[model samples]
Target: MSDAKLQSVLSSLSQVARQLEAVPSGRPAPDASCVKLNTNENPFPLPTIIMQSAIAALERQYLYPEDDNISLREAAANAYGVSNDQVIAGNGSSELLGLIYRAFLAPGDSVAMMSPGFSFNRKLAMSQGAQFLEIGWGEAHSLPIEQLLSGPAKDAKFILLANPNNPTGTFVPVADIERLLAQSDRLIVLDEAYVDFAPDNGLRLIDHYSNLLVLRTFSKSYAAAGVRVGFGFGHPEIIGRLRNIQNVFNMNVIGHAVGISVLAHRAAYAENHKHIKHERQRVTLALLQLGFSVIPSHANFLLAHVPAEQDGSWWQAALERQKILVAFFPDKGLQNHIRISIGTKEQMDAFLAAARDISGSLKMPSARRWAASGSASALRGR
Candidate 1:
């Protein structure tokens, strides 16, 4: 097309669409040999029975998945002790989050979330041209109930709280959440993606509070990230609205089968959950001994402040050189912190060794810039 035609096509885009730049191509997947602790992925295999169910789903490849994911929803309902109408199944909880944003928000509306929570919600709010309010955690990462109830968040269409919040992994008590729900009429989205690792959960609150909506995923504790199974449980009215707007066949046959099978065999993952918790504790202690301050966590990951001599970016680059990959955030107040997912014993050991090496070598007068190609500095264009 000519330049004029291209310009005409672009001019037709909405203001919100135009404001957001297209995503640039990203680097290739990390080398398999690298110890990946960046994303909080439970690097374990499914139970034998669960794998068989997934394989069995192949026989239905020609047919579309169950409409509205009925069977899967039923399985989740049964597993979680809720009615079918109270549950909404999705490709992942992220999909349900998008549906909620669309169902409730319009241009100029506002939404709120616990600060340093999931970053994806910010993009979701932006796409809808809604104001995204980030309320900070109270003392000791507690829930700032009064602030959320009376402050700017009081007027938002909805509020999002992640138990054992992402990037921090600090859990707020269920009582605090219940108190918030009791005092506020606004819809509360409780993301329990890491709740299986936490001490308590707020699912029971849904029985009493119509405003409560709790989300769950099999990705973390159940080791099903690649399969994309997530659920939202709330009052039948709210769940029905989200279900009505959800796309047909959002999940594939394998996801449906695996979801149902996993629900039935949740007890089978007891040892896996135990292992992850063990590793989380072990790594936390190890990081503390290495002079890093790790926030107490109730999730499968740890967010630790890097040593005073170097920032998280420097540690990330140094660890990459050792073939150990962990997460680093450039968001405000997180510049010096790195998040590490708890992996197998061997992976944690390798990471600890690499961390020790980097910690010991921090004798330089200042944080040195890594100049190699694909270094964090290079990748971040610093």
Candidate 2:
């Protein structure tokens, strides 16, 4: 094939990639010498026992992983109080989402999701040629469940609810979710990636609601983001359909072994959960005292509003200079806000100090240059 023909084939493969490349990288400012809080990761390292278990699996390096990953599935099923047949594990919850989409979404089928939610859901829906019906979460970052059920778009085939939503950290109560389940006919996919840190979890409702699928990840609570182990529970029929669409060797040997070890030492993971819950509250309080308007959160991060004059682009740029990174979005309603992941107490102290320093310097004329330079327009156009 000619070079131009190859280029055309690759271009047709993904137009979203072209659009993504045109936008400026919106990553939190990198920290060369400061505490990192951009990603919502556990500040504490994984326990020694878990590492040893993963190392033990390496001894069987010559053998391929088990086709069904039966041991890991059984452990996960026991942990969630479900039958092994109802559980499906994947490289991450991200892959689980893809499997579910592949199983259920035909081209032109519609999926409903909340706006200002996780960007991955929107991307995944569009990639499948599925129409995304986004319901905008207002100032509170709460899912408009009633509007979703009662709106003209009630014919949506699938709905994704990110409890303790990303970039906003707002949660929908179990009562509200039950209400939604009672009223809607759509398959509800609840992304419970952050539920380990929340006061309540959705595992209990899986058996009661046939249409509900709850996704959990070891990345958040198990402190194994690098290992890439995630599982979802639902009706056995739904899980079986997803399993049919997944690759044969989806779970690597090391990850499956580590997952079993983590399940066995559930108490240690519980302790880590207690520590994170405590620190999350402490960080929220500190940000509130600093005069930043913080959205109520039950997760390991906080969504806070900085000054709103020229959106939050100015504050984002200032933090980059201090090597204190946090997530910021330039969407219409969220333009004045940034999301800060809760880290160790020491890390939180450093972030607060950096925030004070940045606020103090904002009065200077030179500090206002980025805001004046049309960064808002640049962001919007993208």
lDDT (10s digit) by residue, model 1, range 147-220: 99999999999999999899999999899999999999999999999999999999998989999999999888
For model 1, the stretches where C-alpha displacement exceeds 4 angstroms are: 364-382
Writing each residue's lDDT as its tens digit, candidate 2 over 1-382 gives 9999977976886554444433467887544786667778777787999899999999987888888778888999998789998899989899999887778887788888877777777777776778888778744565577787888447777888888788778787788888788788878888999987777777788888988999998887888888889998999999888888889989788989889998998688777788777877887777777668888877788888875354566666667667787877776778888888888778888888888765655444653634644343323211
Worst 10 residues of 2 by lDDT: 373-382
Error of 1 at 329 (Å): 1.1
Task: Write down the TM-score of every candidate.
Answer: 0.95, 0.88
Clashing pairs in 2: none
Native-to-model Cα distance after best TM-score fit, residue 136 in candidate 1, in Å: 0.6
